[model samples]
Target: MSGDAPISTPWRPSKKDARYTGPRACVKCHAEESATQHLTAMGRALEPVATSEILRAHPRLTFRSGPYAHEIVRRGDQSLYTVTDGVNTISEPILYTFGQGKAGQTYIFRHDGSFYESRLSFYKDIQGLDVTIGYPREIPPSLEVAAGRRISMDEARNCFSCHGTGAAYGNQLQLDRLVPGVTCEACHGPGAEHVAAMEAKQFKDKRIFNPGKMSADDLSQEFCGSCHRSAEQVISNKLLRGLITVRFQPYRMFTSRAHDPADMRLTCTACHNPHENPSADEAFYDPKCFACHRSFASLKSPAVAKTEEKEGRTDKACPVAQSLCVSCHMPKVEFPGSHFKFTDHRIRIAKAGEQFPN
Candidate 1:
């Protein structure tokens, strides 16, 4: 498989991806910020790979994704990332280093079919050692493309607007129209309107459709619920598999104890870096009950640790439930991505229906 050196033309919508917009449009307004994004993990996932210099540096690189189904290949310096065809519903390959493996390089291949931007491969071992992949909150591959809800007017269909940067939705049956992922306009909307206003000095239109505004409440809060909440599939389509609509579902994060319409109000940007992933590696989000929270002297989920012990070490300052504010409040529970492991987003007392110690 080969990836292109650089896409020369702008993404054109296939009938299947008529509702989508590409990322390039957003960069027109956010050019400066996206530069640093190319370095972070979130940006790295979507980083374009098309050079022989990076391709030939490693002995072996990943060409597929996932642990069981992942594949690896060695590249020659003469080779560059290029697509086999320009118009087919197929993808090219690029090397990515998820982490190191005992034997050598462990990686995943980046791919696109045209209508949407998503990763493939089952992600097995990096180098030769087993590695962690996919954040606790990310959707899986089998269901990512599975057909359930129709793409024309479903929330699931609309989700790709932000999930993908420059992707477009073409004809209902045409997956090839969903091209590219994670472009700037996905969040900021097409600069065609914004840029035009800016050039005309229409300062009032600065936030024509910003998420953080639009109501007395922070409109951005709705952004997190777009993916965090769990809702039923309108149909059985896998491509529409992510949480797109924000209607309340019991299992969804919004209904949990951590979220109270009266007490707690959090937007997507409140606890997360929107330009990034689910923020799993943020030092507190291991599927485990303890990580950074093991130090909270107070019972706040994200509370820092402070010790008042007779004789103990500083580590004790962050006691297990005592240190973990989330543990104390947002009890850990299991979900699809983590069956054996539990999640802590609800952020309330660990013992359900029990009185909180704090």
Candidate 2:
């Protein structure tokens, strides 16, 4: 999403033979989400760095000017630009926050030792020009110059089989890390088929499964709409790259009517604690209305049992107490790389003209 590939096969990672098999080596029963949620970006994007953490502070910096092998991607303080040099090279398109242009994003080059697919800068500035934000299917300005056609690990196993983590798709493919952008076996399953069904204790999944054992209210909201709901496009017309990965179902709260809760055991990790930080900590907000609405005389709705008996508070509330219960139902929403405080998991009602939904 940064480099400009159109010079004839400079981007790489195809013809399979890939491999990343690192981190959990078959997850080992999620082992506390492989260190607080598959190691971090809240779930997956590019972790394998650390040559002394990229030589600390560019310690003498120089992957030989540039062509590839000198890294650095960080967003909110400006850092883009990586390289392993051609057959897939990245670096450029910096703007962690400046009107959030650069249509979502797409930077993952690295090639042979693993990383694939790059180039997706579909443009965005709208009222200021350079439009074309990948509508129905515009990309054909000749595949928008990604080192002239090089994104192919089948265009990156459809966005790395769910933002990658311990993926091993054969004929040569191996990943164990990609940065923390998605994890817990990416929607839970491939820890080498549940670590060989838990060491023959004849394992019935020692943990993390059972969407109430899927009793079907449309298979528990399609097990979180397979990634928060935005399907159909099947192939072509670009658009797709691990949007906060799993349980974002239908993607980014897919028209979230508070994520369709009539309480079919309402899930999305139920008020989301997907390993942490969607502003959690109401002892993990409303476990299905605090397990049947936490006995404010069993709340059959006397105005939500008098607002939980006038916020008497639970387990001792105070999560920045707006009478806790998740500070008046999922609040905050500062946006723009978050240093300004970001919130908004869609659990709504802080309205004012479609106000702050970014």
Best by lDDT: 2
Candidate 2, residue 257: Cα displacement in angstroms equals: 22
Tens digits of per-residue lDDT for model 1, 1-358? 1111111112222333234434454566677766555444334332223332233444443332332232233444332222212232233354333211211222233333222222322222222322232333233344333111122223323433323344343312222433334444444444465666776889985733465543312233333333233323222224432322112222334445334343223333455555654454433533233322233534453323344222222222234433334445544433232112334444443565653221
Candidate 1 positional error at 65, Å: 15
Best by the TM-score measure: 1
The lowest-lDDT stretch of 10 consecutive residues in candidate 2 is 3-12
- The superposed Cα distance between candidate 2 and the true structure at residue 151, in angstroms, equals 18
Predicted structure 1, TM vs. truth: 0.46
Misplaced by over 4 Å in model 2 are 1-103, 111-120, 123-162, 167-184, 187-190, 193-268, 272-358
Clashes counted in candidate 1 amount to: 63
Worst lDDT 10-window in candidate 1? 1-10
State the RMSD for candidate 2: 18.1
lDDT of 2 by residue, 1-358 (tens): 2211111110112324423334457456456656566434435443332321222333222223223344344544344544444465445432111112223233344534444433332112221112112222223332224222344554454444444443434423344433234555454433444455466676655643434455333333454443333322211124343321222233434444544434443455555556654544655555454543344342345665556656542322222333245455555543332122334444545555454443
